[model samples]
Structures are given as C-alpha cells and as structure tokens.
Target: MSPELIKRLTEHQPSLIGLEQCRQAAVLIPLLETPDGVQIVLEQRSPKLKHQPRDICLPGGAIEAGETPRQAAVREACEELLLRPEQIQVFGLMDVLHTNTLMLYPYAAKLTDYDMTYSTAEVERVFCVPLSFFQTQKPEQYRITLPVHPPEDFPLSRIVGGKQYQWRERREDIVFYQYQDWTIWGITAKILQAFARITR
Candidate 1:
C-alpha cells in the first residue's frame, strides 16, 4: 500500500460493520427522585399501536433523520410523557445495544416535574418502579435459539458439504423482571439489566 493511502486509512474512524443498514432507535431510562428513593419511569404502549402494543417499555422510538441519539431520546420522552425539554435532564448514555435488526441507544436521564402524564395515542399508562426494585431483585433468565435458514435461491452446492453443511446457530439469553403485577421483559429488561449491573 502507498504511504499516503495508509495515512488516510489510519485517519478514518472505525465503526460497527453494517451499522448504517440497521434500524436505529433511542430510549431514555427516566429516573424520578422521590421521598422513598429514585424510581424508574416506564410506560405501557398504547394497545392500538401497530408495534409492540401494550408492552411495557421506556419512552422512546425510532431515531429521526439527522437526529442524534440523545436528541431522539429526549424528544421521545417529551412527546410521550408530555414533559418539557427542561424537565428531562439527560445525564449520561448507558450503552448501545445491537440486535439482528436494531441498534438501540439507551440514555440515563432524570425526569423533573413530571406528573404521571402521558400521550394516550402512544402510551396506555405511565408508572414508576423503584430503582431499588431492580437493584434488589434478580431477573429471570432464559435462552432462545435462532436457527439460520438459507434463502431458496442460495447455492448450497457451492459449499463443501452441500445440504449437509452445518450452519452455526445463534442463541441469546432473555431476561424478565416481575415488579408487582407488571412484567418487564425483552429489550426493556435487557437495558435495565445492563443499568443494574453498572449501578451495582
């Protein structure tokens, strides 16, 4: 390689492969300071929604074009919770999660002056669970297997073993948290698990 080409390549920042092709989303893990302690604000999605309706989740949605993850998280929280931008103070970003089709950015924020308000069009209800609950209670864990399937047009004969080729299967662990009558699982629980680990 030429010296100039090497220098140019070195200056390029490395990022996740195929990240540009992945669907991006951002969420705010809102924290409410109360007399008891710090509570986590969660929402039940509107049952009429097309996506994960009635599912318990943090306030967030798809990252809009040209919007940063932090901006998306704050905007989603403000829209869903009916709070002013000043009322949602984002402190830090926890971590970025990668799934088969999604790239999720979870931000840690403090919600001020929020009065259990939410948009009925997007959220069915808003509730708070003590941060202590997650800090104290362990989530139930389960593993799921994902088998790889080749498309019908895929040329299996191009490989050595043909149809007998052993494709590696992927497995992922899922977590569930039971807080009172609420069942928190899937991506929401996964993010919470990460948060709990860091806080501990």
Candidate 2:
C-alpha cells in the first residue's frame, strides 16, 4: 500500500458502539498489485450454508470468545484460505464496521501470491477484482435495494467466474450480485466500502 493510503487509513475512525454489542467478526481485505493492477481478494460462499449463503465475502469467521479481533482476522484467513500470518503485510486497520447482524473488524493485507484453495462446504470459489474498479466506478453502478428500517438500496459488484455483476442492496449493506448469483452485503461490503473511502 502507498504511504498516502496508509496515512488516510491511520486517521480513520468509524463508530464502534453498535459493533461492540454484536458478535465479533474479522476479515482481511487482501491486496495484490499484479501486472494487471491492484486487486482485492474475495470469496464466494457455498450455497449450503444457512446464513449469508451464496455471498461474496472476505475470508473471515466469527471471533472466538477468547480471541481479539485482529487474531480472529488472521486466524480466519488462515483457516479459510491457508493464508499464513507471516505472508501478510497488514498495512493498516480500518474503522470498526457494524452490520445489522455483526460487528466486523476489517484489516488490510498485501500479498504477492493470492493462490487459494476452497472447502466446498464453506467457500464455493475464490476470486480477485481490480481495486481500481471500486475507485473508478460510479456510485450508480452499485446501487441496489437493501433491507433496512425503511428498506434502503445500495450498489454491489464483485468478480466471479471472470464476470462482473452489479448487486442491488437487498438490506442494509447487503446486495445481491445477480450475475454471480451471490448476495454480497453485510460485513463484506462494509469492509470494501471502508477501503474505498481510504483509497479514494
């Protein structure tokens, strides 16, 4: 990550009151700069799960009762993708994110090899999309309806099967990526949005 990106991230402070009250979760927004460009890793959830089934998300899991959020983030990445903690360059921490269902700690990591293997039970696939997409795309491109107090709408997009899909927020920050046939809202988008704000 650039020093400018680091500086911007260091100064961020998103509200945590609501987050502290929910189940703690952590995710790593892994970054990689290829000949193609900077990319962010995302995972496609298996349709067999009961919660957030068929969603695009950062590799993560609920924080164990005894672990810190940072530890949870590193552990979840390792457990999900065999990403070793030593291989990651954790650039900076993002603001504490609150989903309607969980409190998420979003951490940033930069790695050279984004090689991944997925468990059919938890993840259906793993993929990467250029970070520039988020930086350059218009807000209208991601617009989608979300389930909120008043039923809100937001944009959603992610690379899957080598295609980009626009998602409509079906609720909160949760969106439905129709092309990939996955819902990507909640903690995942929250993490990406935080990165978008800092990188922009």
Winning candidate number (lDDT): 1
Best-performing candidate as measured by TM-score: 1
Candidate 2 backbone clash number? 14
Q: Per-residue alpha-carbon lDDT of model 2 for 1-200, expressed as tens digits?
A: 99999998999887656656678788888888888988888888889989877778897788898998888888888777776778778876788776556777888888756576666778889887778766665332244456333222423322442223434455333423222443455456556666787898
**Residue 152 local lDDT, model 1:** 95
TM-score of decoy 2: 0.68
> How close to the true structure is residue 128 of candidate 2, measured as C-alpha lDDT?
77
lDDT of 1 by residue, 1-200 (tens): 99999999999998889888989999999999999999999999999999899999999989999999999999999999999999988899997889878999999999888899999999999899999889888999999999999999999999999999999899999999999999999999999989988887
TM-scores for all predictions: 0.97, 0.68
On the 0 to 100 scale, the lDDT of residue 121 in model 2 is 70
> Which ten contiguous residues of candidate 1 have the minimum total lDDT?
191-200
Residue 172 in candidate 2 has what lDDT? 39
Which stretches of model 1 miss by more than 4 angstroms? none
**Clashes (N, CA, C under 3 Å) per candidate:** 0, 14
